[model samples]
Target: MGKGTPAFGKHNNKLVHVVCRRCGKRSYHQRKKRCASCGFGRTASRRVYAWNKRT
Candidate 1:
């Protein structure tokens, strides 16, 4: 892994598949600490459908 490169399989440390409290949708986001939709600030551990939910 090089600098500035995105790492995989490490969402556990950062908490993967978190559902946005604002939009009530799950996301597979590592960084960018903010919900893609509604710009929420909190997240949870939950897998969501890609097409059905926002990333």
Candidate 2:
């Protein structure tokens, strides 16, 4: 079976959140890499900052 998606929560301690351009799902990762769900990588990914929060 394929690997399951990575978990995202306060306990995981991800450095930043990202949104997938193709799937529009939110995930936490340290670098501007590929989207886990849709396999969209590089320029297709975008950073996500929490509301009223700054990074």
Candidate 3:
């Protein structure tokens, strides 16, 4: 089971709210969007991928 954000979370429920680690703002992090307080971009995965894989 995914211990992360819940599915169908935002529109259906409003009980869960996560504070941005980067910015201390309360927001429904079920969807991807820039922070309302700060312009920091948040993503689901914390991994970085390269455009081209070259050895």
**Residue pairs in steric clash, candidate 1?**
18-44
Candidate 2 local lDDT, 9-50, one digit each (tens): 456565565765567777533385766555566444443436
Clashes of each: 1, 0, 0
Candidate 3: global Cα-lDDT? 0.52
What candidate 2 gets wrong by more than 4 Å, as runs, is: 1-15, 28-32, 42-55
State model 2's lDDT. 0.56
lDDT of 1 by residue, 1-55 (tens): 6766486656557566578665777752447777765445543533345786665
lDDT of 1 at 13: 70
| lDDT: worst 10-residue window of model 3 | 44-53
Question: What Cα-based lDDT does every candidate model obtain?
Answer: 0.58, 0.56, 0.52
Clashing pairs in 2: none
Better of 2 and 3 by TM-score: 2
Listed per candidate, the RMSD to the true structure in angstroms reads: 9.0, 12.5, 11.3
Across 1-55, the per-residue lDDT of candidate 3 in tens digits comes to 4786675456756534467566676753535554443444655443234643474
Residue 5's lDDT within candidate 2 is: 57
Please list the residue runs of candidate 3 whose C-alpha ends up more than 4 Å from where it truly belongs after superposition: 1-17, 42-55
